[model samples]
Target: MSASDPRPAAPRAAPALPGVAGNPRRPYVRPMAGWWLRNPYFVRYMAREGTAVFVAAYALILLVGLVRLAQGEAAWNGWLEALRSPLSTILHLVFLAVFVFHTVTWFEVLPKTMPPLLVGGKRVAQSAITAGAIAVAAAASLALFGIVWGLTR
Candidate 1:
């Protein structure tokens, strides 16, 4: 290749997959400082991922309960006994934290995701929407707890 060859400079490596002019996708690049914290997408992803962890743990608790029921009354009692174990206690605590965090974030995002509810010719405010949702969630949870308590007795 002669120095005088009439050719454009070698095109820069194509930006990763589905590359766009302005929003180039850099799939494998390491996130720079604060990228994880500052990026809204990453924040949402982390919150969702953490919630999944807690859900899995909670499912395991339910699974043990089911197994206990399958094995008759004695096994069910043992399952309840195991529930008092320190490890299970810790797991439940962690799950409670994650569940609350997920609920808060999901509610916060509801206004953005949902269409505005109109009442009496006026659009409901986002804060009001969130508050209403929280109230409904609390009521449902209490109802469920009561029903479960009733059934177990």
Candidate 2:
């Protein structure tokens, strides 16, 4: 109380928890099971993230085809014949769907991840940016397809 007092001040006590006997040390952890069900956005994001597995599987399939091609003409032809089967066709369709979902989700998120673009000193709209990105991707894809078709013909 006095300005010249030499006695150390008493340490303050921890705040008491109501209805609980002692302080709990660990924080509660949420379980990850069914986390995607919590919100529509989370579901969409998770579905987009899950597409990577399918994409990787498709890439591996392509690598296998390349390996078969290296084995000989017979092996390559066999792989192509196998790919012509109903099961392979179904799998490819599913992979294509997943790839499309992944691409759309990626474009949707691109503007958020990247710095804002300015066109003629005005900030570009996010929707326009996404559309422009998709258009560029489509053009590149078509060019690649044309090149491949020309080479194979």
Name the top TM-score candidate.
2
Off by over 4 Å in 1: 1-34, 150-153
Candidate number with greatest lDDT: 2
lDDT of 1 by residue, 60-139 (tens): 87998998899999999999898899997987888888897788778878998998789999999999988888889889
Q: Which regions of candidate 2 deviate over 4 angstroms? A: 1-31
lDDT of each: 0.84, 0.90
TM-scores vs. true structure, each candidate: 0.67, 0.78
State the TM-score for model 1: 0.67
lDDT of 1: 0.84
lDDT of 2: 0.90
Give Cα distance to truth, residue 130, candidate 1, Å: 0.9
Model 2 over residues 32-68: C-alpha lDDT tens digits? 8998899999988889888989988988999999999
Quote the lDDT for 68 in model 1. Answer: 86
